[model samples]
Every structure is written in C-alpha cells, then in structure tokens.
Target: MCKNMKELQTVSERIFSLEQKKAQKKKEMDELEKEIKMLKNETSSYMKKRQKNELNIAGFTILFTAFARSSFDKDAFIAGESNGAELYRKYSKEIPMERVTVKVAK
Candidate 1:
C-alpha cells in the first residue's frame, strides 16, 4: 500500500508539471497571434487607402526598366506592384491606354 501511494504521488507531480508547461506554451502562442493580427491590420489599411491600378495607362506604364544589375525581392513587387496589382494585370490594362512600348533587355 505504501509503495502504491508513492507511485501515485510521483505521477501526479509529473502531470502537474506537464500541465504547467502546456499552459505557458498556450500563452506564448496567443501573444504571437495578437502581434500578427495587429501588423496585418496596419498593412491592409494602407492597401485600402490607395486606388489600385485596375487598368494600365500609357503614362502610367513604366515604359522601360533600367535593367541595371540590382536584385530586389520579386515577390514583394508582384504583390504590391507600382499601382497595387500584379504585372500581368497591369500589362493587360495598357491596351486601353496605348502604353508606350519599352524594351526590357534583361
């Protein structure tokens, strides 16, 4: 009977320790989520304020890229393009505006 009691106490202590660890992890996750939500909200607001370019315009078309050897994150440009649209959409919109044909030799 005494041996059994000792075993039970040991297990209870382990279980309690595990529960505390789990609670701490949960608290950390909640904090991270809150921070991300705040940042996303701020970025989204910027997107809303500006009128995204639906159609490409001749004057608006970049016309030509400097083509200088510089590396920038392509992903960021596509998502938050000049007028706030993808390269494909921006090019298509140019038809109505008769965009200036610029050679991109790179």
Candidate 2:
C-alpha cells in the first residue's frame, strides 16, 4: 500500500508539472501570435503603399491576393426548400468523441 501511494503521488506530481508547462507554453504562444499579427499588418501596409503584390525577402516569398469566399445562406436555403430542415438533418451526422482534461489545482 505504501508503494502504491508513492507511485500515485509521483504520477500526480508529474501531471501537475506537465499542466504548468502547458499553461506557460500557451501564454508564450499567445504573445507570439500577437506579435506575428502586428508584423503581418505592418508588412501588408508597407506593401500596399509601395503597390507591390508580392515580396521576396530572406528567401521567403509573401503574396497578397484578393479572392471571394462563398458561404451557404442557411435562411435562404431553408426558405427556398420545402423540407430544408429535414434535408439538413438527414445530411448531418453526429460524431462520437472522447476527451481527457488535466488541470493543476490551486
């Protein structure tokens, strides 16, 4: 029983340490993403001012392209079809999934 208890404690400690590391990494990633977004905006504005669609710097090529995105109009589809809801439900499927959540308790 003593050995089992020690093993359980070790596992718990490892989980707590991993959770703390995950949190710290997440914070770092968030900060990096913000910096990246700011740099991208600045670069885009500079490119626009110079009227350049593409740029090659340090062996990296960046291209700014404009395109249209088409999205389904749910309301329009439902209005146009007599049994839109039924059809939508028929095409949709429920996917079963499982997840494990770990946290460090304060």
Candidate 3:
C-alpha cells in the first residue's frame, strides 16, 4: 500500500510514464501501417504495369509470327542451313504449360 503522499506521487508518476509509453508505441504502429500500405500500393502499381507490358509483348509476338509466316516459305525458313534454322530446330519443341490467373476485386 502507498502509505505516504510521496509514495502515492511515485505511483501516479509510474502510471503516467506507462501511458506515455503506450501512446508512443501506438503512434509508431500507425506509422508502420501507413508505410506498409504505401508499399503495397507501389507494388500493385508495378504489377499492373508489368501485366500491361506482357500483354503488349504477346500481341507483338503474334503479329510478328503472322507476318513472318506470310512473307517467307515455312519449310525453307525452318530447314535452311542458317543460324535461325538451327535455333528453331534446337528450341521449337512444344512443352506442356500451366498458368494461374489472379483477379483483383474492385
């Protein structure tokens, strides 16, 4: 028990100190949450930019392939004694593919 006024003052001071500490900690947590939110926004923006770029690249690849096929003889292009022919022969084999799609909610 706090027997004297000095002891009572000490207890009050301790409670005030603890409350200040708690407020400081709460402020720090709020700041950290704000930083995390900003980072998530930046990351989401970058991911959207990357997806757009990938779609553009896929479109260009399809257009280029169609143009090449129309402009050149397919058999000659694939079987010619050229570096491109060798690359096509080396890397053109089909492989099974799987992809996962992510949809963001509005």
Best by lDDT: 2
**Evaluation by TM-score, superior candidate among 1 and 3:** 3
Candidate 1, overall lDDT?
Answer: 0.52
Candidate 2, residues 1-106, lDDT tens digits: the string is: 3379889899889999999999999999999989877777777667768877766666666665443443454544564588887766655555532222222322
Indicate the residue-level lDDT of 93 in model 2: 51
lDDT of 2 at 6: 84
lDDT of each: 0.52, 0.65, 0.55
lDDT of 2: 0.65
Q: Candidate order by TM-score, highest to lowest?
A: 2, 3, 1
lDDT for each residue of candidate 1 in 1-106, tens digit (9 for 90 to 100) = 3379889899889999999999999999999989866765554444345533232345433231112233444554565457645554434322221122323333
Q: Tell me the TM-score of model 3.
A: 0.46
Model 3 Cα displacement at 2 (Å)? 1.6
Cα error of candidate 2 at position 17, Å: 0.4
In order, how many clashes per candidate?
A: 1, 0, 0
Which parts of model 3 have CA positions greater than 4 angstroms off? 52-106
Expressed as tens digits, the lDDT of each residue in 29-105 for candidate 3 is 99998986676555445545555322223223211111112233355455545687565655554443222223332
Error of 1 at 90 (Å): 41
**Residue 67 lDDT in candidate 3:** 12
